[model samples]
Target: MKPDTTAPLTFGMLVFDEVEVLDLGGPFEVFSTAGRLARTAADEPLLRVLTVAPTVRTVRARGGLTIVADHTLDEDPPFDVLVIPGGVTTAVERDEKVVDWLARRRRTSALTFSICTGAFLLAATGALDNRPATTHWEDQEELARRWPDVRLCTDVRWVDDGDIVTSAGISAGIDASLHVVARLFGEQLARRTARQMEYLWTDTRA
Candidate 1:
């Protein structure tokens, strides 16, 4: 793995048991591919992507896909962007250490994003306390009921509130990642990244 200094931005994707693979993997592919393409173009890589967990162990995703974390909380590198992916929210949300770690990381991270029910974890950190956020539509009611202070936007594919971004569900994460690329790099680069993935880029919300 490349050191954090090799890339302009470092993205940390949080993972745990039952995490939605696509939620983290989609963005991972986007950012990593974007970086690779940028290097090919004789430009510096835009971002470095890696997965981090509470421990350096394998986690069984919701669908039974086992994934080994790239780093543990204690040894993970600093990240400019922190991506909290949704899946099996109860376990992660209830973990105070994880929430606290997120709170601490937010202070130095340039951007933080949540995909699907991952918003639950982000919200648990009090970062989204009074801000507008969106999550998987299926959990919107529960999220609203639990965190009344957060304004829930259920009608959009994703919500971008400056430094914090949240996407509706699985596939939407890819779109949100492209938007991040556009914001950090440029529109042309974002388009190119999407095209390389053969993904349709729709600037529906952002």
Candidate 2:
């Protein structure tokens, strides 16, 4: 199997059982299609996206859709960007292995992102300590109590706190990914990519 090597932008999206599909897939589409979107009378898609899961077998998402993992965490390469997807299971409050991986990768990645409840995983790594952040609205209360060091915002779609980024809910993940593309490439490119994905890109967070 060959990778979609059109844009040269490499992404690693962490997948596990019950991952919120859109949180991961949204960015994958935005980033992977960037090369095609950026194709300005000359360029095609230069982006390469790999779906990394805990296991190589197809893992079911929260919605019962089975997805084939392109790479396992063990085979994960050094991604230019790392995306952390959220699910209701993420709210269970403890998943040590994932927490550990985020802790390790956040230090090396160019960007670390979280969607909805996935911010809990980032917070577990102490990356957001004393930093401004926003997670799913429902978790704002407990998140504040559990991690008092983090300034949790209940009103934003996402928060870009330097090296780390956090999004509010499921669809907010879409907004976060577009913002990432804009920062890396340009607003024009991001808008182009969003249009291709049929995303409206209405982020009021900034």
Candidate 3:
């Protein structure tokens, strides 16, 4: 589905305990930076990024970093894009609440983005079933083994399957997020956003 560029798109990022810092932070930075660069004195930003968690409590991310969510699952805040970042996802995978919430959101959101093993959570929601997807290289085999229905793509930074986009690993999320920026806005805006962040964006074709 094409994004309505006339207004800002809301990006809801899912965060949880043990979540990988770079996985979440990378995309957050990309979308937030893109929004800032796209904004003008007469117009609003191009995107609005929010952090959503199972609850609005302090989340202990990987490396002992703590984060507070802006919204929770129960609030059911609306978003145009859903960002799922990877980390130690065993507990998240086991949480039926999160899985169900993702499944529901995937149906309504304009785009669903998975970073690293975050693909596993999307897979749990069956969003990746029979879809071309990728994940952190080390976890590819396990993803394939568990979700035989997923058409796994190896040796790629990310896979863009229309509404769903999956990235290889932590830092790769930045690349994929920039690609999304280019897709939604334009390459010019995306390039400017990358330049503003001093990030060398590797734009890959979908």
Candidate 4:
């Protein structure tokens, strides 16, 4: 893995008040590590990971962990991959501004991804319409009731529908990120990265 100077993949994390901290941090860890490790063997860094919120300020997490976003929604440039992590999933799903951003950003990004209850927000964007996806299993029934357009899958860590992808809760975010790594640097590299990170994920190849 070398510095891919041509087109750097921008990884954007969408944060809202009370967002689950783990969902936001998990994939960020994987991709940032991948970028650093790749840089070690290549010319330039491969990822630009940043946290984004309504405005760059301290937003409290679900359990009262405060974080400072790197940029506000309007200030941040476009991202190749936008990750929406679940917080108060229902609250996020019902937010008008969050829905609007996701809808607009989906048009620009190569990939839009969600973790845990974040799938609820993605479904709100109508991006997952007619596509198979999954979220935290606890939210499936409610999600199905609310967004009937998405086909829910029960037995996988993640479902990637080309432009849109969703994963199960918490640690499943690690699997989803590894899926991105697999796509970017090949499966072997992804596996190596997973091993180096000491992450556990579903082995679809098995």
Q: Which ten residues in a row have the lowest lDDT in candidate 2?
A: 1-10
Rate residue 84 of model 1 by lDDT. 92
TM-scores for all predictions: 0.92, 0.86, 0.96, 0.90
lDDT comparison, 3 vs 4, better candidate:
3
| Top-down lDDT ranking | 3, 1, 4, 2
- For model 2, which pairs clash? 6-45, 6-46, 6-47, 7-45, 7-46, 7-47, 8-46, 35-45, 36-45
Comparing 1 with 3 on TM-score, the higher-scoring candidate is 3
> Candidate 3 local accuracy as lDDT?
0.91
lDDT (Cα, tens digit) per residue for candidate 4, span 1-206: 23255656778888889888889888888888777766523456667688888755679888899989888877856777888988796666676876898889878887788998999888888888889999887888888898898898886788877778788888888888888778766777678778888877675611
Stretches > 4 Å off in candidate 1? 1-7, 40-44
Off by over 4 Å in 3: 1-5, 40-42
Judged by TM-score, which candidate is best? Answer: 3
Off by over 4 Å in 2: 1-7, 39-44, 90-93
Per-residue lDDT tens digits for candidate 2, residues 88-156, read 655333667666776888888877888877777778889889999887888789789988999888788
Residue 4 lDDT (model 3): 60
Each model's Cα RMSD: 3.3, 4.2, 1.6, 2.6
lDDT of 4 at 42: 44
